[model samples]
Target: MSQFKVAAVQAAPSFLDVAAGITRAVAFIEEAAQKGAKLVVFPETWLPGYPNHIWLGPVAWQMQFVGRYFENSIEAGDVHDKAIAKAARDNSIQVSLGLSERAGGSLYIAQWHYDETGELIKRRRKLKPTHVERTVFGEGDGSDLVVKDTAIGRIGQLSCWEHLQPLSKYAMYAQDEQIHCAAWPNLKLYEGGAYALGHQVNNAASMLYAVEGGCFVIAACALVSKEQQDILCEGDPQKEALCPVGGGYTRIYAPDGQSIGADLADTEEGLVMADIDLSMIAYAKAAADPAGHYSRPDVTRLMLNSKPQRPVMAFDETAGLAMEAAEGAAAEADVVEIASAAE
Candidate 1:
């Protein structure tokens, strides 16, 4: 479709509770459909919440929350995953969900995209976990960089700082991605400590992605609720300052790098809606399409290995054993032949 309405969610997670988070996410999906939205995007790790505690203290101090976070994370195709997909199907709306994916006992920041029919079209993880995030999450690889062709448009997803990746952005642009879901965690982190983690810089990153890719950017950011703040801060005034209350800065940008989505109070939670016209990308691309007309292949090129980096490979044991036996038989025959020739 050339034109349609989309929603960028700006809210806190159910805070480390997968069941509650699934229910809340389904409600949001239904609400978006009711609002006449074709698609809805969610914030980073909205299911079971972001690991705010990782930023609060060192490794030993963070030990308390690690187990709980892992326990709450959802595995792909698990009950929680199916619940979100069912919601999309029931509502007849597309969904792009940010979540903490638990696969083989390791958690990775992931985004799940479901088509209107409730089939999972794409699932991507952050190629690299940012700073303290590495403490709790595993890293994704090149295979995670994906842009899918949906009935609505070419949609792609990236989480948090993945927006800051120049080459990664180019990869999506090359795929002719039309709607980019930029999932982000609550920007209200380290209140006074890091400017990079704050609102302005991250929003700029999303805008840049829109401009460079000539695609719609739905930047969804999670918030730090009162309950989350209490858990992370633990009543320490110093901790509170770092993990202070509101950290939501959700926004949507046009292909021309304009902020088209409406605003809410940084502390308030709601969906930031925008009407996206895919054809507008042509206008923006005419000005500059980094991966297309504005190219310099001889001067610079990106080497993208879009393969899943797996830790293990399984082969058929029977086949392997048969091959070994065949080789042993061949060796025995060769030895007997040599002995006969000597005789």
Candidate 2:
């Protein structure tokens, strides 16, 4: 019908301080709302902070800070739900914020969305954790890849490096996602090599992918500073954990591979707004659709099916079955023994 206004909020989050981060994020949301933002998206791990210690190698293992990191992380419970919902309702704007979710004694990089009425809209977890992040974060199942139909548009989410995985992006595209949320951490300023290039390339790739899929893409990245490092990094200040300073390249792109805003500052706390005409998607898709005219189903096939479930047994039945099965299997294997003459 009409163009929608979306904002990509780029800012540095306080380390291990959920309350303070939420407070700061709420202020930004208020500002964006005041500027007539219909939807506002945040960077990855903006709730508390990104666990940079995991990248410290041996120091991270010996420090055993993951427990403390999980302790300060947010849980997807009523308390957090209420607080976030209230923030969205107060601002009268739809919000999508990324955070470290602690659930079932496991940690996941998660994104939570709240509607204008303060109702919880959607919650999605990162499909796979990055290289070092696997040691601290758990993998998400298919249930986490959700594309919900919202008032503004059909919104979907993918976190950090997951955008690099073609299959993951295709999954969202197949569902016809309108507004894709791609979240990432700021590139390490000191580790200037493939890591930095990967960040920039991945962001550009995701935007291009969205264009190919004919969807609006919002690429949000965390902006960490020396002050944020002081709070997040619990170890020595001179260590490599805090070596990288700031790398905030938050951006917004349209459905035609056009950049709306790019190369934003780390400390600048504001909204990067764009007016997206949903009709552009129809125009682009008519030319080339990946799943339609562009795909060759004759030579190639990708079929996914659900696996069969294992049988379940009662407690006593399980114990007896295990013992009997073990004894039978062992007896059939070998029956050779030597007798001692002295005995």
> Candidate 1 residues 143-250, lDDT tens each?
788798899989999999988888888777888889999999999787667898999999999999999889999999989988988888889998889888889999
Q: Which candidate gets the maximum lDDT versus the true structure?
A: 1
What's the true lDDT of residue 123 in model 1?
A: 84
Model 2 Cα lDDT, one tens digit per residue, 121-141: 877788789887887787776
Q: Write down the worst ten-residue block by lDDT for model 1.
A: 334-343
Separate clash counts for every candidate: 0, 0
lDDT of each: 0.87, 0.73
Candidate 2's TM-score: 0.82
**TM-score result, candidate 1:** 0.92
| Model 2 deviation from the true structure expressed as Cα RMSD, one decimal place | 12.0
